[model samples]
Target: MSVEIKISLNKGLYLKEPQDSKLGRKMIKHSIMLIEKFGFEAFTFKKLAKEINSTEASIYRYFENKHLLLLFLVNWYWEWVSYLITMNTMNVIDPKLKLKIIIHSFVAAHKENPNVEYVNESKLHNIVISEGMKAYHTKDVDSENSKGFFKSYKNLTTSVSKVISEVNPDFKYPYALATNLFEMSNNSIYFAQHLPKLTDISLKENKVVEVEDMLLYFTNKLLKK
Candidate 1:
């Protein structure tokens, strides 16, 4: 498959933009609504423009195509997740505690973003850390098809791994744990048929909090070993 990419490395982030800016906040917000309503594949410049009360040409002026729009949306999620982890775990001096907090945050966000793109976002981080992203962009790259779609995943792993190392001076296989965390969190929410539903609570309702509780429970249990 010929994958067409649409990211502007030079563009400002949507999360930080002013709400009323023409090609900034309002656009991002509306675009998200469009995605939430129809998913990323069904989202088109014509359809999104109609929903946002704008022209297709105007939408194109910001994003060249759906792929780029997807890249933008994926980047927004990573930035927001990174910001939340930093803000929430800043004061904790214990690396182990910080790791716990970070895991808590990841599980919470997984429950929060619950979509195909955010799932793609999970892959993106792994790719970034492994330099698989650069390979994807390379014309001479081999077996690029199996390389997966994550461009930001490596950074996510590095960040998470660093915290893991902090938690346990002897921690091995940080990336494996990162991968597991991503799979576990993502599966629990998005891939619901394979996941068992809750007893007295709904995973659909209070997702983040429930994920947080689960993460804390897992960490406390595992760390005791």
Candidate 2:
């Protein structure tokens, strides 16, 4: 994974120098700002264009639509996390420790890019939940769009399962376990703030077991026979 001269997938195309980078960062920054100012339900192309000091046509060059823009914003964080993960384990070979360090590295990745950690994650959640609710409640459901989103989510879950298997080979229902693990971790924050009753008491604790801890513990409990 000794990758060099990395270019973020979500960054805008073309430009002379670091302005491209700044402009790209501003897009993500403004996206967060807009989402906060007007919840996902109220988000509009015109608002984003105005906030970024660009026209809808210009923004369209980078993102085809609002959904895609949110997807890019969400994916950017994972891509950055992957980059950080590769950077941390130069000589580490032990699988279990690798996963643990991966957890540590995840937190460090957040530290490295706080924008995605704090801002975009919230926006990402809002977008995801809103769309999901829309599809759920709507009668004519855009089958294509729902299927596409579900497919991407499935792949993401499978990827997490594979990572779990890499650390401990015998975890039963790897993907299912991974799904519960990850879905709980992500939703805990979003849900706890609202439906605290649906959450377990452990999630209420000040010192809680994080997603990585749950994954690592599941690995040890199920695989270390």
Highest TM-score, which number? 1
lDDT of each: 0.54, 0.54
For every model shown, what is its TM-score relative to the native structure?
0.65, 0.64
lDDT tens per residue, model 2, 63-148: 65666565555555455555565666657777666666665544234345333322444444444433323322445335534445
What's the distance in Å from true for residue 58, model 1? 1.7
List model 1 lDDT by residue over 1-225, tens digit each: 443222233243223322335555456666666665555557688887777777887776666666555555655455556665777787888877787778776765533333333134444433222222232354533442334334455566678777766666465676777656655554454434233553222366434566556656665565543
Model 1 bad stretches (over 4 Å): 1-20, 109-152, 193-204, 216-225
What alpha-carbon RMSD in Å does predicted model 2 have with respect to the real structure? 6.0
TM-score of candidate 1 against the unseen true structure: 0.65
